[model samples]
Target: MSTTETHHALWVAYGASGVVGTIRKSDEGYTVTMAGADAAAGTYPTMEIAKGALHSHMTPGSDWPQFREH
Candidate 1:
């Protein structure tokens, strides 16, 4: 079960870098935002699914490609 309780915008970013993705709740359901677009990613029936959709976009891990330090 899910609650209608509203939530502030949820975002995932890396350090000073910009956001990788976001999750928002609406009357319909939770929405995923990425690449600077709305509903660009996917919609979820539950906040948990929406959160899982964020994946590494919010989490910091080696999944992202490695680059040499400047």
Candidate 2:
């Protein structure tokens, strides 16, 4: 038997600095796309969960890491 799949695309994050993200609905869970960093970061049971992860990564720290590791 041939199996079928459904795809649901959602624009979750968008704002200044050209930072954007998307959340796609899947049979298993949801997927998030934050900038060009991570395509398929991971699969979460819920959109909220996935969003939390995305936000964590998207949020920059107090300062950027130094170019030299030291």
Candidate 3:
């Protein structure tokens, strides 16, 4: 079984650009913010959806990186 734990934030990296975005957990939900952004792109109810949102928000034609949770 998977244990539930507190997750604050996670960094996203793709290709040669390391740490391109972030997924932050809040009371409302998970928020995805790209690097150099003033505000979050959006919030999702689940981390899976948040991950998908991050992937969708990325630049077109880019390969998906192997996401590692911290």
Candidate 4:
């Protein structure tokens, strides 16, 4: 059998540069800001898609460094 873990994340698209802001739940829906700006409050159907959208808006070199360093 497989076990599933539930996570909640929020993502924001900041302007033309395509920068992304990500916020997520840590332990039991406790608010946790991952490694970016605080995104506007919203809900996504799945955590994977939400994370994918946040990654898609990365500004190449700059965003990668921030993501890696954190």
lDDT of each: 0.56, 0.61, 0.77, 0.43
lDDT against true structure, model 2: 0.61
Candidate 1 local distance difference test against the native: 0.56
Model 4 CA deviation exceeding 4 Å by range: 1-21, 25-42, 60-70
**Selected candidate, larger TM-score, 2 vs 4:** 2
List, in order, the clash count of every candidate structure: 0, 0, 0, 0
Clashing residue pairs found in predicted model 1 = none
Candidate 4 lDDT, tens digit per residue, 27-48?
4332323335464343444555
lDDT of 2 by residue, 1-70 (tens): 9988786656456544544556677787877666676467777888678777666666565222111110
**Top-lDDT candidate index:** 3
- What value does the lDDT take at residue 29 in candidate 1? 77
TM-score of 2: 0.60
RMSD value for candidate 4: 8.2
Mind giving the per-residue lDDT tens digits that candidate 1 earns over 1-70? Answer: 8878664454442233544566666676767666465445777888777766665454466243221111
Give the residue spans of candidate 3 off by over 4 A: 1-11
Candidate 3 lDDT by residue in tens digits, 1-70: 8998764776564544676678877778988887788999999999889888888877787677556666
Using lDDT as the yardstick, the better of models 2 and 4 is 2
Pull out the clashing pairs in model 2: none
Give per-residue lDDT, candidate 4, residue 57.
Answer: 49
Task: For residue 50, give model 3's deviation from the true position in Å.
Answer: 0.5
| Candidate 1: 10-residue stretch with minimal lDDT | 61-70
Question: TM-score: which candidate is best?
Answer: 3
